[model samples]
Target: MAKRPQQSLHRPNDPAMLLLTSLASGPKHGYALLKDVEEFAGVTLSPGTLYGAITRLEELGLIEPLESVERRRPYRITTSGLTALREVTREMGRLAKISATRLRLSGEFA
Candidate 1:
């Protein structure tokens, strides 16, 4: 059997991307992450969804947990995470430009 290709982690609406974007500003605990993402992205994430993405991001070495404070564990984006976020951001910008151009050509954008 041929080796399977790895799936990309970043998507426009991906929880992982949201988490990474939130952590880009600073370290945050789970609840803080939830609030920041909701405020900035207008997307609410359940505890299960947030932790699930956190696990995957940590496994990929994109984020790392900081010392727990009063039992709340905080996480910070690693250098690799910053790089990944930058790459994903650039890709999204390119896609957005294409989408805007197509929409304008179709008279769907003013």
Candidate 2:
């Protein structure tokens, strides 16, 4: 039997994805997004990293800046971002199901 390549557990270069996902619920300022993402992912993001993610997501049409006269501009997820989030969530669900089945089988054998 051929061995399958090892899968990466970490999401590579996914800060933008994470930011978009967070924004899907509603609009949020930069600082708010950073705080929420840190709480959700358990990772402290530097300003550079957070800003870069926001810029990239904006460029990709995944998010857009909301109406604001303040320096702290809030952003909202676009329809495209919602669609992408839905697809990613579906994939995550599939992976979780597969892992659950494997773990249950292993526990039974043990």
Candidate 3:
């Protein structure tokens, strides 16, 4: 038997997914990440929530820390992180398409 491919364990709105999406643009430190996530996702993450997600992502090898600059440590998404993000993005697109189709059928969307 062949081994099946691993599926992404992230949900579109989860903190980990949000962080990965933000990092997709570029590397950012914790504070910058918090601001960017808020600006884009309209979701505000407290310091504890933000750092906790960062630590989990780092441990999963999805992200890596860069050299600290002026006391702020930045993080960049790893190759695995990019792969995971792409997977999740595709999944979200599919879900959105299905939702739109259903809504349209119900005359709820134009």
Candidate 4:
């Protein structure tokens, strides 16, 4: 089957993109995704929130479950998910740069 395309922009600050981006590296289950996000981005997510995001992403065709040996299902990033990750990362970088410039000008953290 053909892979879905990446997204150009995230759905308005939705945190799911971060989860999808991390999964782009490989397949991971819901709990794994949560731990990875916390380790990589320092973002702690509740189980309910993570499941909700996963469900939404699955519905959107950005991600899907991969076959697994464990009870928990594993998920991988689809083509569309990769695109979304790229877009989200680019936008996040832009926002960070802008924040840094503003901070520097204000001598807040110089």
Best by TM-score: 1
Q: Which portions of model 1 miss their true places by more than 4 Å?
A: 1-7, 105-110
The parts of candidate 2 lying over 4 Å away from their true place are 1-13, 105-110
Q: Write the per-residue lDDT of candidate 2 for residues 6-102, one digit (tens) a residue.
A: 1111242368767876787789998898888888877677899899878867776778898775787899988877776777666676776787787
Cα displacement (angstroms), candidate 4, residue 88, comes to 1.6
Order of models, best lDDT first: 1, 3, 4, 2
TM-score for each predicted model, relative to the true structure: 0.87, 0.78, 0.85, 0.75
Each candidate's clash count: 0, 0, 0, 5
TM-score of predicted model 3? 0.85
* Candidate achieving higher TM-score, 1 or 3: 1
Answer with 2 or 3, whichever has the higher lDDT: 3
- Superior by lDDT: candidate 1 or candidate 3: 1
For every candidate, C-alpha RMSD to the true structure in Å: 3.7, 7.5, 3.9, 5.1
User: For model 3, how big is the CA root-mean-square deviation?
Assistant: 3.9
On TM-score, who's better, 2 or 4? 2
Clashing pairs in 4: 4-80, 5-80, 6-83, 7-83, 7-84
Q: After superposition, how far is residue 52 of candidate 1 from its true place, in Å?
A: 0.2
Give the alpha carbon lDDT tens digit for every residue of 1-101 in model 3: 53211243446668888999999999999999999999999999988989988988888788999999999999999998888788778877777778989
- CA lDDT of every candidate: 0.85, 0.72, 0.83, 0.75
After superposition, the stretches of candidate 4 with alpha carbons farther than 4 Å from their true spots are 1-14, 105-110
Q: In terms of TM-score, how similar is model 2 to the real structure?
A: 0.78
